[model samples]
Target: MKPLLVVFVFLFLWDPVLAEMHKKCYKNGICRLECYESEMLVAYCMFQLECCVKGNPAP
Candidate 1:
């Protein structure tokens, strides 16, 4: 029971870390898309590519 509780607590704490990592990647992709003005299409394409690579379907 003690080991199970420890595992549960570890997993609970770990989830937010994983979520933040994904959020950072997604935000970086958005920032990249926003940074350039003339090559908007290219920037958007790159962002989409990054999202695909990261397995984030709704970014």
Candidate 2:
């Protein structure tokens, strides 16, 4: 029972969003976990992620 309670507490405290919080990009943009369709990648955000910025999206 104690182990189960510990596991639950750990799970509750662990958050993916908190781990991948928004980081500042180099240019006028934001480092994101995932880039939007209208946003263009400008630089590296972190491992597997890149910096993103609002640009004239391709047609």
Candidate 3:
């Protein structure tokens, strides 16, 4: 019973993490905004990309 509970918890957290991994990290609007917003959008985009990559490492 305990093992099953642990597995269920693991699975619950796992799906969202995997889903986040496949999400696209950038949009064109952010690119344009970054040009004028002191690069804030660029940093945000890069952070999101890193999150995606960390969740799903490249080959």
Top candidate by TM-score: 2
The candidate with the higher lDDT, 1 or 3, is 3
Q: How would you order the candidates by lDDT, starting with the best? A: 2, 3, 1
Tell me the number of clashing residue pairs for each predicted model.
0, 0, 0
Clashing pairs in 2: none
lDDT of 1 by residue, 3-34 (tens): 99999999998776555434434334432223
Candidate 3 structure quality by residue, lDDT tens digits, 1-59: 99999999999987765655444555323322123322323224332433111222233
Q: How do the predictions measure up, each by TM-score? A: 0.38, 0.53, 0.45
Cα miss at 16, model 2 (Å)? 10
Off by over 4 Å in 1: 25-59
Q: Highest lDDT: which candidate?
A: 2
Candidate 2 TM-score versus the reference: 0.53
Worst 10 residues of 2 by lDDT: 14-23
Clashing pairs in 3: none
Per-residue error for 55 in candidate 1, Å, reads 22
Question: How many collisions between residues are there in candidate 2?
Answer: 0
lDDT, candidate 1, equals 0.41
